[model samples]
Target chain A: MTFVAATGRAFLVLLEATGALAIFTASALSHSVRPPFYPRLILRQMVDIGYYSLPVVGLTALFTGMVLALQSYTGFARFQAEGAIATVVVLSVTRELGPVLGGLMVAGRIGAAMAAEIGTMRVTEQVDALTTLSTNPFKYLVAPRLIAGLTMLPLLVLVADVIGVFGGFLIGVYRLDFNPASYISRTWEYLEAVDVISGLVKAAVFGFLIALMGCYHGYRSRGGAQGVGTATTNSVVSASVLILVTNYLITGIFFSTK
Target chain B: MPDSTPSQPAATPKIRLRGVRKSFGPKHVLNGVDLDVGTGESLVIIGGSGTGKSVLLKCILGLLEPDGGRIEIDGEDTTHLRPRDRERVMRKFGMLFQGGALFDSLQVWENVAFGLIQGERMGRREAKDIALRKLAQVGLGKEVAELFPAELSGGMQKRVSLARSIATEPEIIFFDEPTTGLDPIMSDVINDLIVKCVRDLGATAVSITHDMASARKIADRIAMIHQGRIVWQGHASEIDRSGNAMVDQFVHGRADGPIQMEILHP
Candidate 1:
């Protein structure tokens, strides 16, 4: 096929696959609402996919928060407005950087593994075995992951916000010689409930997107080793893109001038 | 030869397929295929690579929707069923995949007890107890119960797969490539385990394997698939002389035959 034709075909496949994924995801959600919710399985998945992922998310948040503080202090120092470092750091962690950084870190860490593992299962007929055994593979596999992603991401973001803010305070107090108490006061001075809420909301959405992309790409994977590799790459790319796009939309919703 | 006394249902067949046709895109995988499995019978499906045997098993499991056919289990049409209803039907089946396909996150006991624990929702202690018993039945030590799939050797993994298959005591069992890559001794062990396991469950088995020794050891009847159709089928004892040219060529493992003539070479 010609390049244009091949590209068009691939795009069409993407659209069809996305539609199928949406349908499957909707089915899982519907099943989740009904009887026989697997609490033990959901808790295990939360511990695995969410709690175990904290160190990476925490480290990413810490560095990002510290770097934001340092950069903001320098930029504000040029205008003799260095005290604004506190506001910048607090806003950065609670508003934009915290959730985005946590999501990117998770996309790299958890998303790729989920895709590779589930894609291997797909190619290997394990999923079909589950079906033949009278188990809904979605309920057994996808639902728990989805529940973990949507529920535990917010909790991770909460921890990230606290550690991130502290990282900023550390940078301000030690590096820039700002008064510690004054930094805390300025950080809290202009903060609103909506700011924190929006970040948590983004975290939850990004978690859903990341897990969704991973499972969808994996479950749809074909062939063997090569197919799984392609699925993993697509998962990361799709999730990262969705995170950025959703970030813009969410930010615009919360802070856009009327 | 416990079941060799002659099955009453063998004359009438416990499972039947009629004109089962399936095509993936332009590639027709199963073309007008027909097969039958007797009650309490161990049937082996033998075919070369890319012969659509896997696809055939998937179709019977209702995992892949076939384009045209009638698949009847106990003389009931199971070809078309809603998802929920199909799940109810699936309770009767247990499958052993080529790779074992054990869930790596789950312990050996949990993996064996998956169908019972998740599908039937038996209590964990009871499930674990039963799981260990099944593992014991498969000759796996009780100490292997707590380890994850990644911790097991390849042979152990296959045994776990067998234990998991018989855990629910299914009416039908499907074994895909049961002894594909195992050593000769391990292959004999697995074949023996399969006999013990299926006989213990009284399951009507439909196993697809190219292993001739596995076929001879594990089957009461044998069917050979080629190019998506059953080229030959007969009692396992009669396989050495099925009076069909394709069966003769396939059994003798010959390169030059009607099969060679039929396959394309560009």
Candidate 2:
């Protein structure tokens, strides 16, 4: 009886949390489209989310691409197919690793920061202060973040795609003793416009999810320093997990065999 | 026992509450709070810690929704306004939170001008001019206006928050623990500034504080809350001899009283 009751209680809690998140997402999106928009705030958030995240995302993409080239060369050498290394590196980086890895890196950096900043504001009553001053908390805080994340992540991922492919090119030409022009030509041959576009679409969704999780957790956080800490941790964990899950779903939608 | 009847006549008090109730999942924070504050009056709520004084204030401010009862402001039923309507209604109010609650991200002048620019849609230059004047009224200088809230002392932050609250010349103002975390001199300074600002704006003021000195300094009438209910209320002059045990114990800060502390001994 106790086990069944506990299981039921846990299920109910999950349902409640999901419902709350859905409502919050609806409110945030509605407010973002409404008037009294804060262009200055949105611009500031864009700079923070997109410009600041470039270095980490760029570095991670570079290393991942380099490693992919070296590993693919080794594996394909066994099959006497070492010549396929450049195509493999370019396709894998553009199709999956670029958006996924960049999103995760940004989730750790920007998601955690947003949660911590807003959580501190909540604990200190700044959000209530906004309400008292006739400013909606959603418009002032969440909308800008949502707008920035939705628009900026795709741009970041686009840059990452370029950097990642370049890393692969460097390894294929210098380290593997491949013909530089041939490797470059091979990378472009297999790359379709759909590949980059799909990754960018995924980036946009991941960005929204990251911002939504951070804002939702921070906006409702209580207790104090401890609460803010918990919110920050939750923001990162939830964003990373959601990125991976949605990556698979989006990939299936884009490339599933009929 | 003292009567909870407001000093003002019953006809359309500036703010009125009847049986307003709010509760957490298992604990009732505000149980049937009834009170009134007349126009241009300074009414202070006094209570021990955890007696729902702040919760009652938040409910009246529409920051928290009551589970039951009505809250009327200027004879308008503001209990369940839509978000847009609520923002319209909120334009009449300005509040000083306990910790100053200034936007740490904004400069002191920008904090003061927030309502003017955002709420009223005033131009930046005009708002800045008004903000500087308001800051001066709070005894802060132009040099201080350019600095952030974090750089200011606690008293200065409170003053800046006060300036921000009154920048719009709101019809009603609320001060939550206006003198908490201040030295006696600073507390007295804040109390005096609150009095001056309220008088200048001729605004109806509602303040919640456990500090007896602060309550006496700024309040025209005083109400005491115990266990989420208003126990006794009367003119501030009659507080010392209200003949209500709860008010007496709280006012005198006595350890022995009908209201017992919920501390656990080690």
Candidate 3:
């Protein structure tokens, strides 16, 4: 009976969390469409989430690509398929590594920042002040962030994909003994449009999840400084996990064969 | 100084809360709160920390929903207002929060103009003009307007918050623990500014504070809350002579009385 009760409680907690997240997402998206849109706030958020996050995301993508190229050369050489290194590097970077790694990096940077900021605002009664001033916090705070996340992640991922492929190219030419021209051509040959598009779609979804989790946790935070810290941690963890889960689900949808 | 009686039978109260209840899980914050503030009256709710005074104010402001009760603003039921209606109703309100609650990202003038620009859709230039005027009214200099909230001193931040709250010229204003962390002299200064601002605008003011000096200075009527209920209410002058033990204990900051601090036993 105790075992059943514990399972039931766990299921209920999961259900409640999902329900709350769904409601928050719905409200935020609806507010984004509504009138009295705050263009300046949206632009500011775009810069914060997208532009400011570029260096970290770009660096992560570059390193990941380089390591992937080196690792693939080592493995494929054993199979007497060293020439396939460029194709492997490009395909893996575009299809999986670029979006996933970049999303995780941003989940750490932007997600934590958003949660900390909004949570501090929550504790300080700034959010309540916004309400009193006739501003719906969903519209004023959440919508701009959600919109920025949804739009900016794809752009970031696209850049990450290019940088990541470039990283692979440098490794294949300089580190490995592959001809630079043929290595570049090989990367282009196997790289279908679907590979890049699917990654970008996943990037967009990951972005939305990151922003949603941050705003949701932060907005609900209480108990002051400790609460803000907890919210920041929760936002990054939840966003990173959601990005991985959604990546698999999205990959299955785009690539699964009957 | 005319004492504004708590809801005269002849006039409709500007704000009214009856049997308002709020709780967080097992702990009941507001068991049942009942109060009324007359139009253009400055009503200060006096209570110790965690007595649901802030919760009561939030409920009335529609920032928190009451579990069970009716809240009426201007004789209209507002307990369960929709988001659109809530926003519409909120247009009539302005609030000065404890801890200043100034937007740290914005310049002092921008913080003051936030309501005007965002809420009323006023042009930036016009809002800036009003913001500068409001800042001046709060005794802050023109140079102070360009500085951010972090750059300002605590007193200056509070002054900026005051400017922001009144920027929209709201019909009703709320000051939540207006002098909680201020020095005695600064607290008195804030109390005076609040009194003057409320008087000049002829606006209905609701303030919650544990600061006796602030309550005495600003309140036309004072209500004391204990354990989520208003224990004693009367004109500010009557507070000293009110025979209620709870009110006496709280007003005098006494450790021994009907109201006992909940200290854990070893």
Q: What is the TM-score of each candidate against the true structure?
A: 0.92, 0.98, 0.97
TM-score of the second chain, cand. 1: 0.94
Residue B228 local lDDT, model 2 = 94
- Deviating ranges (above 4 Å) for candidate 1: A1-7, B1-13, B261-266
For candidate 2, write residues B11-65 as lDDT tens digits. 6789989999999999999989888888888999999889999999899899999
Q: Over the stretch A39-68, how does candidate 2's per-residue lDDT look in tens digits? A: 999999999999999999999999998999
Best by DockQ: 2
lDDT agreement of model 2 with the native: 0.93
- Each candidate: how many clashes? 0, 0, 0
lDDT tens digits by residue: candidate 3, A44-87: 99999899999999999899889989998889989999888888
Please rank every candidate by DockQ, starting with the best.
Answer: 2, 3, 1
- For lDDT, candidate 2 versus 3, the one ahead is 2
- DockQ values for all predictions? 0.69, 0.92, 0.85
Compare the candidates by lDDT and give the number of the best one: 2
In CAPRI terms, model 1 is classed as: medium
Better of 2 and 3 by TM-score: 2
